[model samples]
Target: MTSLVDLLHHPLRWRITQLLIGRSLTTRELAELLPDVATTTLYRQVGVLVKAGVLMVSDEHQVRGAVERTYTLNAQAGDADNAEVDHDKLRTMFTVFVAGIGGHLDQYLTRATIDPLADGISFRQTALNLSDEEFTEFITAYGELLARYADKPDTADRTRRMLSTLIVPD
Candidate 1:
């Protein structure tokens, strides 16, 4: 069986997973959100995820003789244990991650609002020098901080945000 990261090697699946993490959306909605991908291609990728038990059809309704499915991440099944640090898998993941970042940035720059300071936009890469123990402790703390917000209730006062991190030994 392909690992979760391997399954996510498909850009469409990766993007779908990213979008569905905390919310549900219909197939039509996903098509609208990912206009660049052909509807057929998107559907194919989604089907793979559904088969793999990562994406669940939360709801379905008949519309004009057709059934529309609303999908949400099946948190339990979608969960992937911390990825093993295999070179090939890491390469594939990084390729997908960088492509996603490029696509998002291209779209974001054209938007009407892009206040770097006001919106807290940042793009910087820095090297870190730390003992193995220190690195382990730092990453562990970071993960805990993220877990603290995993179930934060949505509120009008808070806007959705994406945090992308790619840490590799130098």
Candidate 2:
């Protein structure tokens, strides 16, 4: 359990797992999708995931004396769904998740083209004061809403979007 939780501790690994959830991708494809990460580092992270059993090679073929492999995430392993997830570990996971989102947005913004509204790029913060019971209800509702459509199969008409959420009480 600890190993599973720790496997996603790295920002890159967590992002890789996120990208692989509900999808299969080759190492080269991942590198192209996440051009911000160096080619060598991306390959190393993919290897880590493969060794940890979080990701398995779904396809392999020999072409021009090179083996091309594609990977897919093990069932629910890419998600931080351990029964032993404590507050501290949860915080660590959330921190890593947020950092990865921030990094990706930062990298994307570096491109010469800038169009936040057209792309629907939005960020906002609000303070919610709720009693313990209300807070629990809020969390449950949020989780249910996210889960309802989180695993919708990727389709040509649908575009990939990143959504990260954080909840903290003062």
What is each predicted model's overall lDDT from 0 to 1?
0.83, 0.83
Residue 70 of model 1 has an lDDT of 98
TM-score for candidate 2, residues paired by index: 0.70
| Residues 1-170, model 1: lDDT tens digits | 77777787777788898888678899899999998899999899999999998899999999999999999998776355354657787777788888877766776788787887887678889898999999999999989999898767668998766678888888
Instruction: Mark the 10 consecutive residues where model 1 has the least summed lDDT.
Output: 77-86
Candidate 2 residue 3 C-alpha distance from true site, Å: 2.2
| Candidate 2 per-residue lDDT over residues 1-170, each given as its tens digit | 34676888887888898788678999988988888899999999899888888999999988799999999989866454677778887888777777778876986698799898887788888899899999999999998998898889889988677787777766
